[model samples]
Target: MTPPPEDLASEDAKIPAPASPDALRDAILSVAAGDADSFAGLYDATSARVHGLVLRVLRDPAQAEEVTQEVYLEVFRRAAGFDPARGSALAWILTLAHRRAVDRVRSSQSQSDRDVAYESRANTQEPDPTGEAALATLEAQRVRTALEQLSERQAEAIRLAYLDGLTQTQVADRLGIPLGTAKTRLRDGLLALRRIVSAPRQRKEE
Candidate 1:
């Protein structure tokens, strides 16, 4: 079934404001540099959605919880592997969550079944994108529209890296492109989206 308009509007509400790239960079640096509290902050910042993605794909809260830990462990273990050039730290962790969830789903069941499950649960829960400040949903829609203007490949790469939980290598593997191609697509895609998001007034003026 198609998502209800309200659901789409609510979906718009969950993406949050642009995380301070500098702050996020600092967090990743902390983790990479061995500060435990910084690592905890990173986990706390992203765990819910990661858990939600897991549960959506697996439909098991217990398994989702386990996967959540696994996702973070991987994040901590692979902190050095994170590529800030591609996107924000949050996007990196989210990509891990999505890809891990995808792996669990695909490893056990048919892709079609997993997609159906993912879609069914998606409309039921809304992601609260606002970290603290109150931003109206209408403004969120405007941002979403701006994001829609990016090249499809760029957008796809971002989704794959961030939402699908694939590494740049895995993205290249899945897309049948070279690692360099995946990296380029991921970077260009995020830059395009960032430009659209950063210049909201420009888009509005247009």
Candidate 2:
């Protein structure tokens, strides 16, 4: 069976020490042409420095190790894109390592920010029993104040029809009044309630 592509760099990975700048550049160019032996030589020449740079930026040994493997794989794939005329081969490799490490840091931070925002929204939207009770108390006060302005029969009709959930005909029967008279009392009571509710706001605006 054929070994994995990563094993290609594993063969002579630790066989040789570091190479000179020109020799490393030559090896990188050879690896660009599909030379597995030269890639192993290139890995031997720069893997330590690349791993160290990644470790320093990431600050986690396990994550650094994972990123180091990714950097070498990137080097294997992008060796052909290197331009010696622009810079040395080691400089190109270190650039790849640093960029990968910083990207991981940024991705982790972004995920953390999203988690915090979701938690904040969840807490804000949760129902509050105290606040709901306070709102109900304020509404009851408004209804009581509006009823004071209505006639006794009108107030009684509205309470039976709306607050007690009675039908209009039932309100008329309970009060011993006609259906039309009950409807007229409910309508007048509602108009008076609207006027009383709006009075506070209109006064504030004026």
Candidate 3:
């Protein structure tokens, strides 16, 4: 386990605006060797870029800020395994930030899906062939229209996962994205559907 950065030398804690690649690499190495002060320097040098990448992926400034902190903690623990031959230190750090951000988005989306699913199940009605046939047709039409409200990727995700009965893993593979991203798309698509479906009810109430 990496120790906390509290005991680091105050003199070395000050970070430059944007350290050179060589400088960043050296700081990572120092952190790997249990130099907290060097990790602070690395954090200062690359934090904005890390946060920006996370924000682009997540589109939530609050979540991006939280994930940026996680990225730095991960860097402290994993810096020992970094191979400069594989990539630049900045690339490695940004990759971690992106992954963490995606994970958060996926988790949040999955929870939303679950909530929507539970509500749907709770509201399920007993079948009436005469009424059911008409309702099913109407529901199908509503779904088709609602799908149109999604973004292109979200629509594709919904078609692949729900309509085609593919698992999330399968959708991820088909889309060539991480499973987290696939879940996020599906979640957003479902949320859109829920909103579209509810809009009529809201209008009637109003």
- Predicted model with the maximum lDDT: 2
Error of 1 at 201 (Å): 49
Query: Between prediction 1 and prediction 3, which has the larger lDDT?
Result: 3
- Which residues of candidate 2, in runs, are more than 4 Å off? 1-17, 123-206
RMSD of each: 15.2, 32.5, 18.1
TM-score, every prediction? 0.45, 0.50, 0.50
Clashes of 1: 4
Model 2 misses residue 148 by how many Å?
A: 85
Cα lDDT of model 2 by residue, 55-172, tens digit: 7778887677667756765676577789999777777887788788887888789779968987878765644567857996897788778788888987897688656656666778
With a 3 Å backbone cut-off (N, CA, C), the pairs that clash in candidate 2 are: none
Name every residue pair that clashes in candidate 3. none
Candidate lDDT values, in order:
0.63, 0.71, 0.70
Per model, how many backbone clashes are there?
Answer: 4, 0, 0
- List, residue by residue over 61-157, the lDDT tens digit for candidate 3: 7667656655764676578799988777776776677678777888899879978887888966653566856996786687778888888999898
